[model samples]
Target: MNSFDLSIETYLSNIHFGHFATLSIQAIDNLYTFKGLVLIPVLWWMWFQQDECHEWRREMVLATLVSGIVALLVGRLLTHWLPFRVRPVYDTELHLRFASGEIKDAVLTNWSSFPSDHAMLWMAVATGIFLMSRRVGVLALLYTALFICLPRAYLGFHYPTDLLVGAAVGIAITLIMTRDAIRVRYATPVLRWTERHPAPAATLAFILCLQLVTQFDELRKLASGVMKHL
Candidate 1:
């Protein structure tokens, strides 16, 4: 890490340990669930119900999500070309809140941490929202910075520049998606197909979402419980 990356990353790369600390970590780690799943939907729903252009709002929401996933993929590919770096905990002498009891699966040591997929996805959604409502977009940006980026840094998952460049990738892709020509050429067709087959489209979205987020405490527990009988 260069001085800029190291200075900011070091400033952020410390955490508390214990049960409460675990809870806090899990909560921040679920920033995607709230911002992407909860907040974005809520904002879109509010706008949709009030707007004369309900269909447009619906299509835009779907397009925005697609943009987020695409941004994540693009960022993922970018990491392969950059100098390799392991997750902060694995590569550096940072203080970590290992399994002090908030939860298990305390450390993920091998994953590449060059550009954060979380940063890319969250910023893509934020960019999409900002396109619609500046206030909501700014709010989402703040939440992404504090709740999403900070905790990941504190927990030793990423360097600040990793998150920063990932955000840049997301913003770039989302801005392209927001273009009128691109929307007319690409997004409209996808929306039309989705309108024609909402069930399959919804199913595909759920599956892709599963690929994006691997940690789900309740869901994992439920899956484990079900597997015990088999």
Candidate 2:
């Protein structure tokens, strides 16, 4: 590991018993709940759909979905198939737990903590949207930092390095997809014609329908996990 990685590990280790760490973990874990994950996306999409930049909305939506899915799949495969790392909660030597109190039985996984899923997801969304609107992009980045990154570290689910790496992956995927989308959506004569006379309402509806269909499998999985926990 490099000096940066070592520094992060040391920092995480030092905070094992801190009250702030306990609070951060709790806040971070709360974001994994169904409402935070699902409702936020729905509201975000709805808001953007109503924006005046309707022509760019489709590109933004497509980029967000494609980059997010790619990041998630790649992150999962890398974490699961590569050398696995136990979470701090499961590390007896670390003795990390809720500093406020003892945690109840929680569903834990023994996966590598190199790239945090939450960080990647939000970062992908932020990056994709940033390609569309700078203001929205800034807001998205802030949301990811305050809600996703900070909370995950506070809760011991991931080190700061994991979140940082995940953000990098998300940003990279977003940039690639956005560049490709621009090339495909604008470079073609037929596409340029369509853009000049955009069917915003119709396009928005179609994209929304596609999103609902594409998200069904993921939503089902999330529901199943919630049921299992319940």
Candidate 3:
């Protein structure tokens, strides 16, 4: 970690909100719940809303969702392929303070923290939303920054640089994936397929959304289990 990361971590650690620390921890723990509640509704509205450019909006949303999945895959691959960096919460040298003192049970002890997956996934989704609709997209970005990324730093799960790099990667990949040519070639066809097979498509979309909300935890666990025996 550089001086910037250390200074920021130190500053966050120094501030204590007393009993509010527990509440903050709870908020951090339950953040995934908010994902389905907030993002799913916004996505649903974005997909079905009637407007002059509704078709483009729907296609863009599809591209954005596809990009989100790709960004997450990239994040996971990078985390494993790159050097394993210790999380701030688990770093003994940092001696960071955990006001709630309950973080150990709540966080992943084994995962690397650099280029946070949370930032990559959510920021990509938010950037896509912003590209589709400025007003709602701004709200989504603000929510991701404050409610999603900030809490991870506050809880010492990630350094600021980790979030920054992950978000940059996410935004960049989404921008590329949602380009007119790419969307026309890929997302448009998928959208048309869904239109033709609404029942199965809806079921698969629901499953994918559930995975996004949970950060693919069960899927990862199952993959790990399968890999162990192979």
lDDT (0 to 1) per candidate: 0.69, 0.62, 0.84
lDDT of 2 by residue, 29-49 (tens): 563442135423643574357
- Clashing residue pairs in candidate 3, if any? none
Instruction: Give the best candidate by TM-score.
Output: 3
The estimated TM-scores of all candidates read 0.74, 0.65, 0.93
lDDT of 1 by residue, 29-140 (tens): 7555644565455444543475676656656666676787688777767777777777765653544333222332433444478788788887887878777778877888
**How many residue pairs of model 1 clash at the backbone?**
0
- Models ranked on TM-score: 3, 1, 2
**Per-residue C-alpha lDDT of model 3 across residues 1-230, encoded as one tens digit per residue:** 79999999999888777687658665764667765357656887898889899889988888887888999999999998999889888888987885535456533677889889888998999999999889999999998888888878887888999999999999999999998977899888888999999999989988888887787888988988899899
Task: Pick the winner on TM-score between candidates 1 and 3.
Answer: 3
Better of 2 and 3 by lDDT: 3
The worst-scoring run of ten residues by lDDT in candidate 1 lies at 98-107
lDDT of 1 at 48: 46
Superposition-based RMSD of candidate 3 using all C-alpha atoms, in angstroms: 1.8
lDDT of 3: 0.84
lDDT of 3 at 100: 39
- For model 3, state the Cα shift of residue 47 in Å: 0.6
